[model samples]
Target chain A: MAFEINGKTYETDEEGYLANLSDWNTDVAGRMATEDDCDLSENHWEVIKFLRDYYEEYQIAPAVRVLTKAIGKRLGKDKGNSKYLYELFPYGPAKQACKYAGLPKPTGCV
Target chain B: MKQIDWSSLVINESGKAVKKFMYVNRHAPHGTIYPLEGLEVVLIGAAFDQDVSMAFIGDGVFQLNKGQDTADSGMKNVALTYGALGDYEVTKLYVEQESLDERGLELNDLMNLTWEDEEENWAEKPSIQVVSRAQLSDLLEQQDVILNF
Candidate 1:
């Protein structure tokens, strides 16, 4: 599949941008930083990938409160906790991360 | 391009290339978070520029609450879903003001953040239509396609 962002065309696997989006989870956030073309820090990747997985399962992006604890439980150490999650994505973690992942916005947000 | 008026909680978009949509989130959170249904519509709606309106009524009014807590149950909340609708330039977010007041919620405290400033107070913002039982029945009759969640 091909998608154009900012007028640049890029080819993706059958699952749309899932391959590229999923590759940036916590461990690979930094390595793919240059490739993904986003200056995303690890913290940024943490939230983004979490949101992607959440969206994949439920088919709905989660609000902040859900992002906070879900990350905390899954990654351990609260993964920066609520305050940290807010710092990473002030416009709201799920929304910001989804944009970075090149995925559609989460569903039923608000 | 299937034209669907999705006021109910049924997820009409799955495994397809949706071209037209009518999202109606008529169920409130809590017992009927039905966010999943609305969420599916919102994401798909954001992918195109057709007839897509996420209208809120009845208990579904709570779907727009500012603060939500779904993580405790290991579930993600529905805030971002509302935010992403703008990316696709959703037609408009319709809210029935009467629904909020009836639930003891004020308009200011209820709304998805994605609709901030411009979109939040969009001139085309959802109408807070307060109606009598007679009005609701009449309104239902007027809709070409209606979904009740």
Candidate 2:
């Protein structure tokens, strides 16, 4: 789906993903952040970017264990710890981030 | 603290044997060990001195499908476990319809087992109540001693 926000045309998927774009407007970003239940911050983007890469590669959303390992490798061991991971996405990282990324809930999420 | 009892491994709680159990299976077999572990428990539920009801939902439904043919998966191929269920007195098998569709599976995929009592089969499991997502929560709310696989 394409939208003209503040006269800037942008594209997203049916689930509201920014198509081939990195930057986003404050309001839309905020909305996405709220939907994902994460406070808007640089840290959240790290997880979000990781999720995008995961979905791109596996074509399936990862559960938290997979997410944490991937994050630990890319970011650092501190970020990948289960307690820290849950602190970032209280409802659960893989679940909340997938929602914010405008993707369907991952398989085996339950 | 109430001790958790695996269905297959459990014969008596404290001292008395229990009957009329509800067994819930919650995983797919391949990626996780939960499925095989769940089946072992289900077999116990069947061996219990009382009646047992089996509920297959989410990826757990994979356990009941017939002709699974997975001997090469380097596991016990626990798919055969469902066939032996009836032999052990586990006659009632209830599957959530929504979960079937979500996984693009159907009743036809299951073993040619008898439907549970017609009352539950009318709606939901009609045997035990095939729960939709919300219905699952409600059903869980009603259980007294539930064993999840």
lDDT of 1 by residue, B39-145 (tens): 66555434443345556777777777877767787655655456544434563556676776678887677653443233343333432333445655555555545
Top-lDDT structure, candidate number: 2
For every candidate, C-alpha RMSD to the true structure in Å: 14.0, 16.5
Clashes of each: 20, 9
Pairs that collide, model 2: B8-B44, B120-B125, B120-B126, B120-B127, B121-B126, B121-B127, B124-B130, B125-B129, B125-B130
| Candidate 2: segments with Cα more than 4 A from true spot | A1-110, B1-20, B114-139
Best-fitting candidate, measured by TM-score?
1
DockQ top scorer: 1
- Runs in model 1 lying further than 4 Å from the true structure: A1-110, B1-21, B112-144
Per-prediction DockQ scores? Answer: 0.11, 0.01
lDDT of 2 at A92: 74
